[model samples]
Target: MTSLWQARSHLFNDRTAGDYHRRLAEGLRRVRDRISRVDRPFTGITPTQLAARIGRVDLDRPLGGAAAALDELEELYLRDAVYFHHPRYLAHLNCPVAIPALLGELLLSSINSSLDTWDQSAGATFIERRLIAWTAARIGFGRGADGVFTSGGTQSNLQALLLAREEAAHVSEPRVLTGAAGHFSVQKAAKLLGLGPESVVVVETGGDRRMRTDALAAELERYGGAVIAVVATAGTTDFGTIDPLPEIADQCALSGVRLHVDAAYGCGLLVSPTRRHLLDGIERADSVTVDYHKSFFQPVSCSALITRKGGDLRHSAFHADYLNPARVAAHLPDQVNKSIQTTRRFDALKLWLTLRIMGADAVGLLFDEVVERASQTWELLADDPRFEVAARSALSTVVFRFLPDEPELADQANRYARKALSASGAAVIAGTRVDGREFLKFTLLNPETTIEDVADVLDLIAEHAARYAALILEEPHVPA
Candidate 1:
């Protein structure tokens, strides 16, 4: 029993501090080696192949040491992992995290602090509150503004809608109105809130992919007093287009409807030296969702939901005797009361460290670089006859597709090109359907990505698309 207890030196404590230091150093070294050696965004390893490799590992048998465990992890994860840090990784909304944030991640993981209550987290709770206040101030919210960090924009949107539902409890039917191009989470939130399938009404968008204010006004009049909230998207997923916030705010104000802005993708503009005016009317939003992971170059799962009125957060509050009883609510700063999650990680540390070390302007400059690159990419696509570009984004996404001579073959060609590009592991891009037609997307979040990289990826896409089109043309045709 003494020997068995001695062998288990993995627990982190004063006695095992040396062991923890050694293990952590080894893990960081392995990760640094992998990041330095990664050449492409992906290895194109199929799910079946990787699954089989992972299945061979014996979970019951211990590797006995950190080095051996890391060796196994490299084969199972690090080696074939999608390297978002690579400049060619243009797919999705993932960003190459800031170094300061990475440093915070190390400390937060080691400390393992929970932000549920004052006693549990102490000074950590105040840090989170201070950060929330800073974000609210950037959005032009007053002293009554309050917010809580969340897992991501999805949870932020969910909580915002929950508050809106509670506020509209007097109505028999409450509807959520948003742009047709808004994030799908709004619909999901409505469903999760027990609002029926038809509770969400999508307002039509104009040629620029922004919600038409005329249509929104009409919808508001059509719904009469039943509309609960108007969700204005500051940045859309595909086009990165921002809705007409000023006009939307006007309509919502006149109709006495609560306004929620899902700026998950556009919140970076809050500190943007040049483009801050694009989100001019965002100050009028009753609630706003911001994803620091998406736009602030922080690690994953750093997001917050801010409200103009602090009391609105009570909609998600539930008291438990042992955790946070109502008797101590006024005396103690308990974060769990404002959050849907009970035991949440201290993700606020990452952003806190990021802001402390790099400052908001520095982070905004990184985003500005990417946005500039995206504009140049749009011009490249618009001038090239081989492709048809979508609306020019005010943010950092470009939606376009290869245009072949035969209109019917355009969809198949673009689809094949996206798959081939991913399979070849040259560069990564995203695909989406626009108006029932297939299209490719470039979500440029990496500041290191340049026009040269964009040009190269475009050439690769064109080559793959042309090859697919030719192959389709050569195939033997059959009469229907």
Candidate 2:
């Protein structure tokens, strides 16, 4: 009789190919079945329940075969997974990935290419460089621009800030300035770089929630030479607001401050047919971060950190003997030379394949459609008396709160409604605290998501808020 290890062998040998194909086919079928069966984005289970269910699996002994393990995964994991592809998943920056990118992911994983050095990656090195070059041109960075693929928006921002930090090493006290609405990562990056939290000065924003140029100028003047980089947000998180980039760029130029635009959320507009002009002055920045995963409809971990000057990438370079050996590093294009990561995934293939098959204009059109949908959804909310909608969206998010009859209960009502709606699993959305008040947010990333979907979610929100408000009114309150 054959032993268990012999019967179920690994991938190093010949027989594994047929077994791999069979298992992968089964997995694909299960994915299709899950997509068809699950109409909701979530399974309405609490975090504690999910943890307990998954914790029951014993790791001591093997399940004995691939089919059994896959079956177990389907029951414990896939059934409750948050499905971004679900039309009702209007929660966050998550997007429905393109089919071409998925296909590229499949190929890249099977090949298992590591993109650190030239010999290791070979054609993959050039492929990534090509994508970076193409993206730099899209931003109109011109001839001298250079960039490297990163894990996501967070990592890309960190790398951009790292470059900015190195360039300012000559200054005695280096600092960074950004708008109040900028991503939290800005502060985190500053701290990690040994600049201390105080080094990040938060400039105020206007009523529309965009960085006030006057305020930013004042801060720059106050800091003077201490401010090494002026960070401008192309797309803010809560309100989807964009700063006046052209104006900010002018200020940076006058002061000789290094400019870095965080366009992770709005990078999709780079290809937009009508909205491309919104990103004006982006090319003027010293550095920029673009997250393809967020707005390019690629899978997760697809982002790039680009610089206006190719030579600026040297700030992040350090030679490794085992990896990018000195002998060959001079001649070939080793990706690790300019990147913060080693053993990076070949994620650039996803966008390359996407562009080859679907074309850039097609992806841009999808983004345009969703942004247009957001405008229509905003009108639906603005016209309704039940909600107090925030300012018109600059991208694809609408932030608003449910208004009950009692003014004091508005915050409580909105928070309660979001929780109740999530538990029902009819639809899923995100929540945020704007100006110390709770509000519900609709982040429309799917072009297929319609205004009718927004209306349905709004109706559910109102119903839940009304029920919660009634319960609050019926309760007896004791004075503190």
Candidate 3:
């Protein structure tokens, strides 16, 4: 018994105390080396090669023993992982979080607290509650408002549609209506909530990306009670457009239908006093989805679903014998009852620490600044001779392309060029089809990125454009 106790103590003790400093120091040095090496304005690993390096080996040994097959972890996977924290990374909705949040992650995993209940989680539950309540207030949810942090926009939307699904069961199949600007996750949520792809109908909107109230009314009238709920986009991914949520809210109120706002992207601006007008009707939403990773500058895996009523989550409550013992005992709070997940990470801790170190308003200023930079870039791209800017600025992402005048060759050339461009080790931006034409996209989520960085990206795209033009010229001329 004494030997067993000693063994267990050693297992949980500082297993790497002697080497922790060394490993961290080496990693920091390597990071410094990488940062000094970059001269371009964008970077991310190629998807195909990154996929090839991904290797997982489950440590099924059961008693704190680590993987026996991870010798390649550092050399193959860790070092080559996509460097989003790089100053040049302006390619996606990903953000470089505050270092405090990263430190919070270390403390959280060490404590390993589960925020499912006020009992098991103790202080952890309060931490989550404080963050949720604070986030709700930012969205103008009144004193009694509440919410839960989820995995991502997809899961938050799943929970949003799930609430509508359980409440409006009387509505027939093919029962959901959403703006064309809404994220694809709403449709996925519909399918998971018992309505398939056929059930989710897209209501057309104008170029401004606001849902047409007339179109929504016509569809609702034609379909009658077949519609269970209506979804509006707070920030659309395609063109960084904000669909008119206030109009959709009014329509839902008139129609007596549920309103779910996929505010995953735009919700971050709630803290930004200057940019908060973009999500004018957020408080009116029956449910709202926000991603902390996008705007609040938290690590990935930090998203949330906020509802008008805290009790609305009963729609998904379930009693699992082993998973949710609190449900069986009837004396403890079960987070699984509120969310579609169990064994959830203490993601709330990072958000809490961030709010403490930097007030929500400061984060709001960051949002406003990024949007202002995007506007600055929008004008810059318009004046540049080598590129074209498409769409009005809604949030941070600016869609543009190379060789604006060569529209006839734009489509075919972009498809082939970006494919080769990413394979090389220069700048990396995304490609999007705007009004059926391909344009390079620099999605500005990083507050560290600058308008000058946008100029660097344009230079890279122009260089690639010359090469792409030569490659196209080499192809045999074909008669249309």
Using TM-score as the measure, the top candidate is: 1
lDDT of 3 by residue, 310-412 (tens): 8888887777666567554477546667777766788999888888888788889988887888888888988987777777768888887777345677666
Clash numbers, per candidate: 0, 0, 1
Which of candidates 2 and 3 is the stronger one according to TM-score?
Answer: 2
Query: Relative to the true structure, how large is the alpha-carbon lDDT of every model?
Result: 0.93, 0.89, 0.75
Clashes of 1: 0
Among residues 3 or more apart in sequence or in different chains, the pairs in candidate 2 whose N, CA or C atoms overlap within 3 Å are none
Give the candidate number with the greatest lDDT: 1
TM-score of 2: 0.97
TM-score of 3: 0.87
Report the poorest 10 consecutive residues by lDDT, candidate 2: 471-480
The C-alpha TM-scores of every prediction are 0.98, 0.97, 0.87
Segments of candidate 2 deviating more than 4 angstroms: 1-8, 12-14, 476-480
**Candidate 1 Cα errors over 4 Å, as ranges:** 1-8, 476-480
